[model samples]
Target: MSPSETPEVVLHDLRAGDGLPLVLVHGFPLDHRMWDEVARFLPDGLAVVAPDAPGFGDALLTESEPSIEGIADAVAEALAARGVERAVVAGMSMGGYVALALAERHPGLVAALGLVDTKSVADAPEARDNRLRIADEAERTGSVAPVRGMREALLGETSRATRPDLVAEVGAWIEEQRPEAVAWAQRAMASRPDRTAVLAAYGGPVSVVVGVEDELTPIEQAEHLVESSHDASEAALVLVPDAGHLAAVEEPEHVAGALARLHARVTR
Candidate 1:
């Protein structure tokens, strides 16, 4: 795909043996490729759908405002277009926000939810300020350098040295992204709503996963989600050792394991 070429929306459907649908959502500044690693071990006989968020990857952003709701709507549209009715939606970071929005906006569409390395609360003032600051930097610097910093921020501190291959894979993916898309996503995520209430209100099987070394969305936030989730009894928390924000990439096997277990729980 060329740098300027923007597809309406990129949807990748990987057919496993086929049972229930597992929809994977990517985080900000990234596309569906982030799930490639973990998708390998997600078990057979389950359909895996990884859609690139609008304004990211092959998915183009034709909309004026790309808020969480907008992204969720676009995803729902894409799923509908592809004949997906009910799915086990799993999201990471920015994708997590979209997942919650999806569950809220179209409850019937989600059979189960997996929130990974993301928070249920809205962006705090300080967090919003940071996103805005990054957006300003992206606007000024054309989004590449700032996004590079974002890559570092998302990965664990030790990943740079211990997991060079993972870092390289994510770095290449970041470099492949369009600058305009990154900036737009930065703005959208900055303005996203608080979804703590969404979690508390939604009565569904939810799986919350976090990385031990994830500084961005710390364990405390995961704990809060565990406490607040409506189906707390069914809410499963998997803390991956030596992993960080991007758990799927940092420890793909572990993330996949958690996802497989969640899938089984919801299906059974």
Candidate 2:
């Protein structure tokens, strides 16, 4: 893709009376497909928009290095391009970072907010360096190996022990991604700044979902979001049992239920 061009997004049934527009942003190493299960249980009237980030899923990597804020801006542009001026914007993990950036940079475009399995703080020094290391390894290998093990690490203990099919499915998704995309995501995440203030400033209703067993971004992270977002008129924090970082995939029904509630808040 060109340096200035934004990745295009697929839209679903935004016709009149289709209800509020919603955009679901995917996390790192995964694509729009990650939300397949959650979308199934969302309120029926939503005009859903799910887009692969710049380099994950079937999208191509750009010549320029991708930034979370840049990706958020691109998503905003993409939505406007699709005749959507505003929508309920939600994301998971890296996508949550992008969602926060979007609200920071283009608050007018976000009618409501949903943050799933994500945090508002920037990576610590060691974590940031590790991400850079992984990015370097991925670029050198020209493969997603550097992040392949995350498929297991991302799951909760219960999932790792009992959900072989889920593990295999996550592994398959990770393998399909290109090394460039992985590197791009790592670079973007490594340099991200704390977004607690963004969440604290947001005026819309908010939803925060995380697996109770999610070690990566734990329940504390979810609570921090709720505590920091006192400005939001409403906030819902959901903990999915027996799931992990990939709660939306590990236990779709629970994740879907959280999103359904967010949709209700948006329309209420």
Please report, in order, the local distance difference test score of every candidate based on alpha carbons. 0.83, 0.85
Q: Please, what is the TM-score per model?
A: 0.93, 0.94
Give a tens-digit lDDT track for model 1, residues 19-53.
67899899978888889888888787878889898
Task: Put down candidate 2 lDDT per residue, 1-268, tens digits, no spaces.
Answer: 5765554434333222465777888888989888887777676666677878878876677675567887898888877887788788889999999999999999999888999999999999999999999999999999999998899878999999998998999999999988988998899899899999999988988999999999889999999999899553367889899999999889988887888778777678
Best by TM-score: 2
In candidate 1, list every pair of residues with a backbone clash: 17-45, 18-45
* RMSD per model, one decimal: 3.4, 2.2
| Model 1 regions more than 4 Å off | 1-8
Give the C-alpha lDDT of model 2. 0.85
